[model samples]
Target: MSTRTAELLASIALIVFSLGLMWTVHTDGLKIGWVPERGPGSGVWPFWLSLGMALTSLWTLVRWFRRTTPESRNEAPYIESDRFGLVAISFIALTAMIFLVAIVGTYISIALFLGFYMRFVGKHSWPMTSATVLGAVISIYFLFEWQLSKYLPKGLPMFEDGFLWLDNFRWEYFM
Candidate 1:
C-alpha cells in the first residue's frame, strides 16, 4: 500500500482499537470518575486515549482527502525494492522478540531489544550499550513491580515459583 494509504488505515485502526479499549473498560464496571474528591477511575485514561486517537484519525482522513502534505501527494512508490529487505528484517526481529518474551519474559525481552538495537544498529560502545540495557530493565522492573504493583510475565519455569510468591506482595508496594 502507498504510505498515505497505510497511514490513513493505520490511524483508523488505532482509533477503532482505542474505542474498543474504552468501551470494554467501561462495560467492565470501570467508571470514568472525574471529580477531584473521587479521583480518576480506571476508565478515564482509556476513554481519553480513545478520544485522542479518534481525533488524530479524523485529521489523517482530512489530510488524505486534501493531499496537503508531500507524503499525501503519493507520487513515489510505496516501498522501494532496496528498502524492502530492511523492512522484512525489522518485522522478523519483532517476531523473534515476541518469541523471546514468551520464553524469557517482558523485562528480559526489552533488555534484549535495547541491546540489539544499541549495539548492532546504533553502533554504540559495549559499556554504553550494556549500561543502557541494564538501566532500562531495572527501571521497568521497579515501575511495574513497585509503583504499579503489577507482576509482569515471567515465562521461565525457574522463575515461575518466585514470581507467584512475588505476586502476593504486588499490592504491598513490592517493598
Candidate 2:
C-alpha cells in the first residue's frame, strides 16, 4: 500500500486500540475507596493516557483524510531504513520481556532489559550503561516499592497470584 494509506491505517488502528484501553480502564474502576477518597486505583493513569492517545489518533486520522493537495502528503520515507531493524528488534524484545515478567519480578526483568538496551542499542560506555541501569532500578524501587510501600509483580513462583501488594487488590499476609 502507499505511504499515506499505510499512515491512515495505522492511525485508525491506534484510535481503536486507545478507545478499547479507555473502556477497560473505566470499567476497571479508577477510585480506591468510595467514601474516604484514599488513593487512585490501578486504572487511573491508564484511563487518562488512553483518552489522550485516542484524541491524538483521531486528530491525526482527520488530518490524513483531509490531504487536499499532493504537496500536503508527507514526503519522508514511511519507514526509514535506519530504523526498521531497530523497530523490529524492539518489538521482539518487548514480547520477550512480557513473557519474562511472568516468570521473574518486574524490577529484575526491567533492570536487565535496561542494562542490555543501554549497552547494546544505545552503544554507551560500560560505566554509563551500568549507571543508567542502576539509576532506573533505584528510581523505580524507591518510587513504587519503598516510598509508596507497594509491591511490584514478583511473577507467579514468588507471588503466586502475580499481583503487586501495593495495589492492595488482594489480601496477602506479607503485604
Best by TM-score: 2
Over the stretch 120-150, how does candidate 2's per-residue lDDT look in tens digits?
8878899998888889878987788767877
- For each predicted model, how many residue pairs clash, with residues at least 3 apart or on different chains? 0, 1
Model 2, C-alpha of 152: deviation from truth (Å) = 0.7
Off by over 4 Å in 2: 7-76, 158-175
| Model 1 residue 23 distance off true place after TM-score fit, in angstroms | 1.4
lDDT of 1 at 99: 87
TM-scores, all candidates, are 0.50, 0.51
Winning model by lDDT: 1
